[model samples]
Target chain A: MRIEIPGEEYMVSGHLACPGCGAALSMRFALKALGGKIIVVLPACCWSIIAGPFPYSSLKVPIVHVAFETGGATGAGVKAALEMQGDTETTVVVWAGDGGTFDIGLQSLSGAAERNDDFIYVCYDNEAYMNTGMQRSSATPYLSWTTTTPANQPKENPKKDIMEIMAAHRIPYAATATIAYPEDFIRKLQQANSTRGFKFIHVLSPCPPGWRIDPELSIKISRLAVQSKIFPLYEVEGGEKYTMNFEPKGILVDEYIRLQGRFSHLSEGEIELIQENVDKEWNRLRKKAGG
Target chain B: MKKVLTGNQAVAHGVLLSRAEVISAYPITPQTTIVENLAELCADGILEAKFLRVESEHSALASIIGASMVGARTFTATSSQGLALMHEMLHWAAGSRLPIVMANVNRALGAPWNIWNDQTDSLSQRDTGWIQLYCENNQEVLDTVIQAYMIAEEVYIPVMVVLDAFFLSHTSEPVEIPEGGEVDKFLPKYHARYKCDVNDPHSFNLMVSPEYYQEFRYKIQYAMEEAKKVAKRVDDLFAKSFGRGYGPIEGHLCDDAEVILVTTGTVTSTSRGTIARMRERGVKVGLLKIKMFRPFPREEVKEALRGAQKVAVIDRNISFGCGGIFGHEIKATLCDEEKRPQVFDFVTGLGGRDVTPSLITEIIEYTCQNERPEGEIIWAGMRG
Candidate 1:
């Protein structure tokens, strides 16, 4: 069965993304939704490589490859210049990896959000710093096995709540998305492109190499994440009002964890702990959305 | 329009006349006044540009690059620690060949946190690929900013018009702020050949393999070398229109002198006064004010100081583990000379302790007497 997606594809073939890379699919879906009139600000990320080297770009849109920590600020700058030039049409999208968004780029991201600069900032979270050989970043999930976070000592803390951080800035729109649901991802991107102020979308992209999952299981594992309530799909309009995009089926978190080798060492007791934590977080999101 | 303005005000006025489309900066000592005045210019509708008040110096430079990528003429200002903070982005701006002109008020870097006039800060970024143009006074500070845009755009290299922290940035002086029409003739509107455009999408400064990386670096090197000629051509055109032009190297009374003192920034004026006093006492003394530091003015520096029997450098900053940065470059430039003059360095008045005319005269006298530096550097004005 073929799904009817947007006909216009902005991403070209022969790019440098890994096989079944969720970030690559996310970029494809994002560019399809945003269309041709756009500038993609890519920080130092997998997309930096995925966009190909100089004189070679897989992206059909203009790409401004900036410093890792300067994505938000650079997008704001491009938007400001466009506005000054009487160009209010072209949209500026800052597509950064999780490390750039949650850790190194947080200050500039926060500053841009606080100023309400007009641009769409999307964080394609692949759990860890995959570009630098899967180093553990602030966005790395709990008990995930990164190179730095070995099996003996995995990440101890939960992933940073970046959407809530953006919400605290009272931006016009903030949403969580995933490539498993193309409509949800495209809708959030379109919504962000429509609004005037700062719009942030946190896309939970999966990584086959970094997550230690089979190449074909990238989309399946991504779907399991949302289905198991580990990664919820939601939106916060006007920063204060939260709207749940989809309710999870309340499946066992074990299915999602067992799919990736990163969580292969997790005992049954640890799996129960993760379920309790996910349940508490889901309930909190529900309460915030007035469910 | 001749106006009595400080160096900071002059830079703002220059930026205004150049029609900068995007201005981004963070407030630092000495550099603060430049951006503050630019903000007022933006607010009063005098300058039509997008003013971005960034959180840090790093973002300020990044924002300027971002704006420049979209074919927007951009400008920014910073000093000392601020310039140091924008170190990484500085390389990006130059390597990308963005042609973003910036005014860097030169101040000493901090350990004890002193915000004073020193050349160390700007000189520290010598390897960052920015064309460094040190200003001698308010007029040069103003005119250099205008000239910088023209030079940067032509050579595709970013320019940093540097001035002494407070000596030039804060002190008011008579400077001819060129009219819009005059500046229009000097510097036309910036139209980027390859910028971020929706119609023609491309990536800028992306990762390059080892095979292609050397070529890109060589291109930057070619641009820098080409800038020396471009700087001269632009200044000549500027002189043709404005009746005043400072070249890459300026020689004052060096035609028939035995000892010449090399200086940069605001101290050039003091060197002039010291030379005049020495001339009154029948001493054969001359002055060489270096305006351009990046291309190092190598051949021109050698030619200017070649006539003298002895040459002395008054460096306000030291390059730790070595002598003055300028002294090292000067020696390296003149090393292949068979008839090169005896050279020495006088390290003095650091942290804005005031490099007076009397101090300069003493250095001149010392240069006239010594064949070469006895030790490494002559610590002038120090208690030791």
Candidate 2:
């Protein structure tokens, strides 16, 4: 078996992404897979600023910068317009952040999935609203310390199961991939590229700024998430069948949390409680995957 | 061909004739039938286009903006609340300079949730940079939508063709829909100076610094000013082909009159009968119909009301504690004139209340008789 990366690059250097910005790397990998025949519909997110200001862009492909909640809807429109022009080669990729996908953009995303509008919806989850200075999002994990969820009272609710929600739409394809696993990310994108109907890819993007981690640990944090089974990598097809992509080593969740300052405020009791919840979720996922 | 149609159906017919490549809409009262009929047109192959039944008005407008960015003619329709929901994207469409055409059925905004006709919904968005056109009847509704695309594309700005709720949207009237080929001959396929092209790539509507942002705002304002001329030119071309021309502002019997009643939307239709009745009594009064509300038509309005002693503006919408919206604009437009007419703001038929012929007649008499309105806003036909 061989691991290969696509030679072509759509995301060039000189972009404003910080050190170990997983979302930036995720886009770089996405563009490599999607190639030149794509248009990115971006809602307000980190990339809205990261892609540079007016009259300048980091990516080679065209970007349609829309409001925060309009990613899926805008992508559908762009795809339809291209179809009407008798040019269906270009793929409309809705690139959005966690807050956009899990909260404001949910209706639009669900609608697009229901219609099975021909486009790829990529929701890169950096855990919270990183662009707005580390506010909490529905996608923010339980016991995390975003600005909104301060150190005193960390995020109370568990991270939303967007994969399950999207799978319920019974879309053709729904997959999870992270930048730490480029081969996995690229493969999933290529799968989405080949699929005919609506496809969703959830990328577990790591943010150094909002996560209060050393910029060097962004990718390391992502690798530990999979290793600890806190953020599992998997795919769902037709909103029914679930396939686990990687098997975590059953490592302690503390190995992942200790590297990031967001979880530093948690006591021993809270850490154990989080570990128990992760075990329960892992057991349920394993059951579904026939482990 | 003469077909009796509701204002919504007229919009659908116009969209079909104009060959709008994409129609994205969500159903809201009064605006529902337009997209419903459009869906049928799409299904029957009468119109070769994609009809996107969106989840919400936000998505509806967002989708249209996307389609328009791809150099395809796009359209959508909604009313009051739905229009309000799409308010944020309205700026996006205008700022991106995408020439998308939309039909807005004028429904009242709600705290009590009213679905009737009122201009407040569209009037509230006057500063959004959309070229707003108020329709007088079903015929005008059908004609203006086609002209909206022409003007919108020419100036690279979005156009909103607005009509009153049930009075126009639900009321059936005879409309002469032009043939598709003839409309195509007049309004050709959209050719974009800039768009989302794959082979030829460029970023559209991205982040702007304070330094260059003002220049973009200036360009949109300049385009809006140009839209005034483009609207008239496209309307003239529409007339040359179809024999129906709707100027930005049309002054009726204003050649010599003491009082002029200014109206917009379907209320202008209701005002006509009152004007005729007043004329039989030998009262020298006239009607000034504002078809184009944006670019305000300052010159035409100034020229039309120059000699009139009293100019009464019958607004179906108010600016909340400030009097009527049109009243404010007309007053500001006439403030510097050497001999400006005393502009009185009279609000009538709000929240779909009936603006009857008798009411209009009484309003005309009141404006003619009083030197100044006793109050800033005269609420017509209110029992309380």
Candidate 3:
């Protein structure tokens, strides 16, 4: 079987994204699948800087950089205005970071989801607040070393299950994709594009400097996250029917943890604990998928 | 057609007539009826607009900002706490230079948690780059909302049409609701000069270095200066269509008066009656109702109070530590004037305390009896 990716590129170069920035790559793929008929509602994220400064934009699409916690509401508004204009062809996509989706912007996002407002919300999860110099966010994994959560006292809480929260809203579409799988990423984005109301796509975006990984190893680490079953490639339809898009090799969590300095302080025992947690989550997801 | 409408319902009718393309709002007391009326209008097909019942006031304004960015005429309404919650978005809306109009029903902020009328809610937002026009009655509330869209769209600055809670928001008054065709002729459909478009794509509100950041703010200030003229011109145009006009400030019997009471919102109505009775009783008292507070009709204020020896600024809202918010602005406006009147700040009717005719008379008497203001703020009708 053959998989196809669109040749047309909506994102342009000269953006200020760091080397191997997964979030930036995610946007490139997103715009590729979404085509030119979209307006991006960007909140306070790394993309805010990566989209280039004033008088210079890195995308061929129009961008409305809104307040930090207003990603969902702003997108809803754009879609509403477009609906009023009788232009239903344009898709209003909210390109937000994990901090916006999981933390400060949660209420607005939830509000939009609850109302089943017609828009696509994409959260590029880099695990931490990478734009703000690698602070600990609710999306930051347990035992990860961030600027706020130092090595001695790493992040005590586990990464929030954002998918479950979004699924509870019973939105039309919700999916998880990573940059390592461009075909899957593009396919999911296209699927979200076609869906009518309140679609959410979660991309496990990697950060090089913030994740304490070699810039070149960003995509490799993203692949390992999926292979280890730590970050599953999946989709939820109407908050129920779950389909695992990519069946992982189900490797141990050590390979995913060892590539980055964020988890360097973790002992063998802690790695085992993380493995147990990942396995538990994988099992729960498998049961939901009726595997 | 003349209809007896509350200030809130008048706002809905104004928005309906103005042909606002999108309406996004969250319900808050005193402001709820405005949105409720709008919802019904949209449902009944009387207003062909999309009404977004957002979760919070922050989203309420944020959504409208997005709508306005995409070249849609948008509006929202909220009271004190809801307005306070929307403080961040208020700055965002103005900074983005989206000409969105919002009706703010004046309600007191909480600590002890009061939900009644006061000016502090909108007054505190003076520097948010929004043109604030306070209304003295329901008629002005409806008129100002329509004029706000014209003025804001002209200058590309957000405008806040503010009215007192309960007094104007709930009280019914006969308002001349203009026909849709006449309003359409007066305030035409909003066509954004710059907007988010697919054909001509651009990023807005991006990170700007110091080299160009100051210029953006300079333009906003420059636009504010332009808004003062636009506001007056829009009012003139509105009167040409609707047969009634409200200037930035209105002065009654100020030419030969010894004492002038400066007021805003519904209190101005009471002050008007008090000034007439005082004039009949052989006391030289005048009434100056400030309709626009933001691009604060400074020249009009100075001209009206030039002959008056004593000016009492009646504030239904306190600025805390400073004096009345309007009182401070009035004092600053007259600071450079050669024959400026002695401005006395009298704070009363806070937290919805009644600003009765007797209260107005007492405020005037206090201004007359005193040689100068004994203090920065004289607490009127306050228990010892």
Which of the numbered candidates is closest to the native, going by highest DockQ? 3
Clashing pairs in 3: none
Could you give candidate 3's per-residue lDDT for residues B34-110 as a string of tens digits? 99999999999989999998999999999999999999999999999999999999999999999999999999999
lDDT of 1 by residue, B1-384 (tens): 778999999999889999999999999997999999999999999899999988989999988899999989999999999999999999999988989999999888889899998888989899999999999999998889999999999988999999998898899999987779988977888888888999887878788899899988899999999999999999999999998999998999999999989999888998888799899999999889988999788999989988788889889889998988888888899899889888888888789999988888888888887778786688897765
User: Which 10-residue window in model 1 chain B sums to the lowest lDDT?
Assistant: B375-384
Q: Can you tell me the CAPRI class of model 2?
A: high
Q: In terms of TM-score, how similar is model 1 to the real structure?
A: 0.98
Better of 1 and 3 by lDDT: 3
lDDT of each residue in A5-66, candidate 2, tens digit only: 98998888778888889899999999998899999999999999889887789999988889
Model 3 — TM-score against the truth?
0.99
Q: Kindly report which residue stretches of model 2 are placed more than 4 angstroms away from their true locations once superposed.
A: none
Q: Residue-wise lDDT of candidate 3 within A38-148, one digit each (tens)?
A: 999999999999999978998899999999999999998999999999998999999999999999999999999999999999999999999989999999998999999
Off by over 4 Å in 3: none
Structural similarity to truth (TM-score) of each candidate:
0.98, 0.99, 0.99
For model 2, state the Cα shift of residue A41 in Å.
1.0
Q: Is candidate 1 or candidate 3 better by TM-score?
A: 3
* Model 1 ranges off by over 4 Å: A1-4
- TM-scores of the candidates, chain A only: 0.98, 0.98, 0.99
